[model samples]
Target: MRVLMRVAAGVLILLLIAAVGFFALAWKGEIEPVAAVDRAQFDQELIEQGARLAAVGNCIACHTVPGQPAFAGGLALPTPFGTIYSTNITPDPETGIGKWSEEAFQRAMREGVDREGNHLYPAFPYDHYTRVTDEDNRALYAFLMTRQPVNSTAPENELPFPYNMRMILAGWKLLFFEEGAYHPDTAQSEEWNRGAYLAEGLGHCGACHSPRNRFGAIDPERHFGGGEAEGWQAYAINTESPAPIPWDQESLAFYLRQGWHEHHGVSRGPMAEVTGNLGLLPDSDIAAIATYVASVMGEPDAERQARAEALLAEVSQSQSPALVDAAPAAAAQPGSAQGDGAAIYAGACAGCHDGSRPQPFGGLPFSLSTAVNAPNPQNIVNVVLYGLPPADGEATSVMPAFGGVLNDEQVADLLAYMRERFSDAPAWENLVELVARTRSGEHKVAIRPSDGIERGPENVGASGGAED
Candidate 1:
């Protein structure tokens, strides 16, 4: 018995020592100050470099609120726990990063620790920012310094118990964060490498596109395979994406630059913000991104292609030609229900979306659209309630929120008209319910057609309208 006790005591001592050593290492990992960049280094060239980096990073999409100073930061991002507000990134002495030394910034960017050694929530997208080159980091820092300082103290995040604890983030980081700069692929072209660096590092596209684990850390195994943010379904950018229409490089580039296309889908929800920002980048940079994305496709497998084709054919065949022709004829006659819908469409929707003028940033036209033909009208109803804003880098086209302007009945009537006139699907009856659910913030738009019931033409006329 005595020998056993002694053995247990020895094991206990060893365990205590290990625990102490582990904590000591963690403590040592706290934020450290670094050498400051000389004021002389803050030149126009550096600022320009920073601007380019910012474009790649798409900083304004998250940092700038509508009608607010660029990068001043007041965007409210919702998560599973609660809402977290973006901080003031401007170089204000009190509210922003004015006092942070270059080393402090580097630690935050690479190690996910703030200047005060507080473990920053990964909501800042620092996981992907960890891959940014030091030079680019320096340039980004310089550029941030040049912005006008705003005295905005962000609201405290309303996260649940353990998540609110900053120290716990250290453990999360230990599992996911890797300290390093982007290493160019020797085998890929210079353009591809550049695209990779921008996409993975400063751009941090994976922050939204990549799926996350239960712990909220991105699942590296399923990189860019779709995720959620701010109640919006951020779809996968991978080649294997189940989008009804496959995204070619040209269409992707056009969508990124413009915001919409005929063959590809339109940007709505969070993607609208991304496209708005990407639209501002140089054409050459956009082309580079396009080229890199194109390289990802090496002819989809025959089975997948066959399945997609079969699905499309099935959807096409499902519509009745006689009903499709008769529905429009009924809509054309004055005093008919379709006529009421037409009047609503002309009065409420025709001001901006008539497809006659080229949409700013080459936005897709709404006339005779598949989105309109959808059986589920929830997306359309939601859009009519909350108008979509143009993405950060794209052409400016603000769809005004009609939540206040149109009541539930008006929205439903308008949608009914559009569907009957433009499509052959059944009318949507769940529109009012969908609007209530969406307005109450109960549901979000689905990312893929497979995720929910396909919206049909009849439902399109019944539900509401498309905004994105």
Candidate 2:
């Protein structure tokens, strides 16, 4: 027994030493780089393409905070581990990527290493960026390098021990990261391939739409099965979708490009940022993405799709108009604190979401609303708490923020009513707790919840259809 114990101790010591040595060597990356492009020479075409690519990646969305110069990164993205502040991508020599050469930039994107050879956290989404085409990478570099330099330092990362051991990421890359470029599928159509590349490579759509494992790495098996972002659930765009009017390429293209569609609805939460950024792309690029996503999330058969639309049109999106007009009845239990959900909707939501109303606000119907039928009721709760930020620049939204107005119980009541009336799905349990957590900012949300993005009062949400 004594001899066995000694052997085990020796093995453990050896393993620890090996791990320490391995980390020391691996942390200082030794990978070779491809030939560096001549950074001094770039043209308008590269700059233009880079701009388009950046829009697709929504690079500025994570890097910039409200009131900050674009790409002067300071936003704190909350993750399970800790807050990871985005780094400055501007051309500032002291604080931004200005000092990085083309070789260093490409290595950072391709191998998840920084200019000084330190491993970059995956929070930067270099995993997807690794698959970006070299041509696109060149363009992105050209575009980013030309940006006006902003002299600002992002806050230091606030990660805990072990997690903050940046060298440990070497193993994480070994386990989860793959180095490669987008490989076009020969069997698929050119349009389909283009869309796939955009969605999987540049768009990095899965970052939000796909759930992560305990390690904070995306579960590859889930693919487009819905995931959480900025505390809001990014709805599944696959067969798992519970949308009343099944999504097709046409409707999706309209939604992606315009930020709203008659069959669907206006984008909100993190999706709003995505849709807004996508608006910068050409119509053809948007259409290609829609096509690829539609293929993945094949629409309901023609019959069911048509029938669902017809039902929505006939119903004018009223699940229970009579309920809305009725007086509030006593709680099902005498002492229960639950309020009348229908009455609340009548006072708050009906003026716009009710189909009988006029253009943008009037046209959006609730009975067939996707949020009402979601597997989890988080989407509805999110919209109610945060409210759709008035999108004056794109699809102008009229929805008001109830986060300050309604208590948790009220939001729960409203959510229950929406689910019961619009969808046949089971009632969401523990909604009050959920609302409380969301309001208190305990939820790991990826959205920048605000009242409006326009040059006006922060709390003033638009209330009418947009002119542009």
Candidate 3:
């Protein structure tokens, strides 16, 4: 018994010593932060480039809270540990990074430390940001410093116990963080390489799109397979899409550029914000990102894709043909009474989404829609429950939310009906529960598409129209 106790004590002491050493080395990183007085001067060009880089980083998305000054940073990000509010990143000296030196800012990005030499939470995504070039970091600093300074102070993080200990993040970083700049693939083209850099580095698409392990590290093998963010599904840009149509370069570029592609469907939830930021990027940059992602995602089975597309086309033509007026055609298989799936679609959804209206107002042929054909019908449910809002603050045509009007079973029936008619994919299970969960705000957009072919027309992009 004494020996066992002695051995346990020794192990505890060893762990204590190791923890102390880890903290010392993590904080004593090679970076020598520059003095505040030695910060770089902000050039106009640098500011503009910084703005572009910021867009690439999607800085404003997480930093700015709704109805708040941009970059004043009060958005609360929910993690498994607890909620962490985004810090003020505007040029305010007290609450923001206004007083930070270039090296301090660089250290924060590269080493995950703050101006005060404290470990920053990985929620800031310094893990991926570490790969950003020094030049780009400087530009980001310039852009940030030039922004309108706000004095808003974010609420403190609400983490529990040891997880709340900022010191623990050092170990997390040690375990997972790999600091460096992106190295382009020599075998790939310049465009492809640039896209790779953007996707892997500044864009940090995988951070949100890739599923995380229990340690809160992204599962590398499932990169771009789709993940959750801010209560929305970051759809897979990989081959694992539930999208009926395979995404190619042209389709992706169109979706990213317009936020609404005819066949792919409109961006909503978090993706709308992403597409909005992508709009600020150069066309070539957009094209490059599309090129790389499409290549990596590769194509789905060609034969499966063809059959689904054909099925979708036939369904659309037969069930919801172009209307002579604003009226929908008779239902193929009417339900005996109210709440029948086809009847519900015709009465509630078909007028706007039957592909019977003019450009920008009509819906995609159900066969070509990414939403209906998605592996999970949550996107369809999202549209049905919350309705599609004006994207990017632009008052494009809008769809009314059905949360107040439709019951859970009704929504489920409508969705199942859509899958049955528009897609040859297997009908989703637990739809009633899915709708209820979505209504209660417990559901997220699907990251992984269920096994099936996502068939659709090529280049069928973010088309102008309201689709359910």
Q: Who wins the lDDT comparison?
A: 2
Supply every candidate's count of residue pairs whose N, Cα or C atoms clash at under 3 angstroms.
26, 5, 13
Q: Which portions of model 1 show Cα errors greater than 4 Å?
A: 1-25, 28-40, 296-381, 389-434, 442-468
Residue 465's C-alpha lDDT in candidate 3?
33
Using TM-score, rank the candidates from best to worst.
Answer: 2, 3, 1
Candidate lDDT scores, in order, read 0.64, 0.75, 0.72
> Lowest summed lDDT over 10 consecutive residues: which window, candidate 2?
449-458
Give per-residue CA lDDT, model 1, range 290-350, as digits (tens). 6666666435677756755765454344244454344344455476656766666665665
lDDT computed for candidate 3: 0.72
- Candidate 3 residue spans exceeding 4 A from truth: 1-24, 28-40, 308-339, 358-360, 392-397, 442-468
The TM-score, computed over Cα atoms with residue i paired to residue i, of candidate 3 is 0.84
- Name the regions of candidate 2 deviating beyond 4 angstroms: 1-40, 301-307, 317-339, 392-397, 444-463, 466-468
Superposed by TM-score, candidate 1 places the C-alpha of residue 281 at a distance from the truth, in angstroms, of: 2.8
Which digits, one per residue and each the tens of the lDDT, describe model 3 over residues 47-138? Answer: 88999989989899899987799999988888765689999998787788777778888888988888887788888988788889899999
Q: Cα deviation in Å at residue 46, candidate 2?
A: 1.2
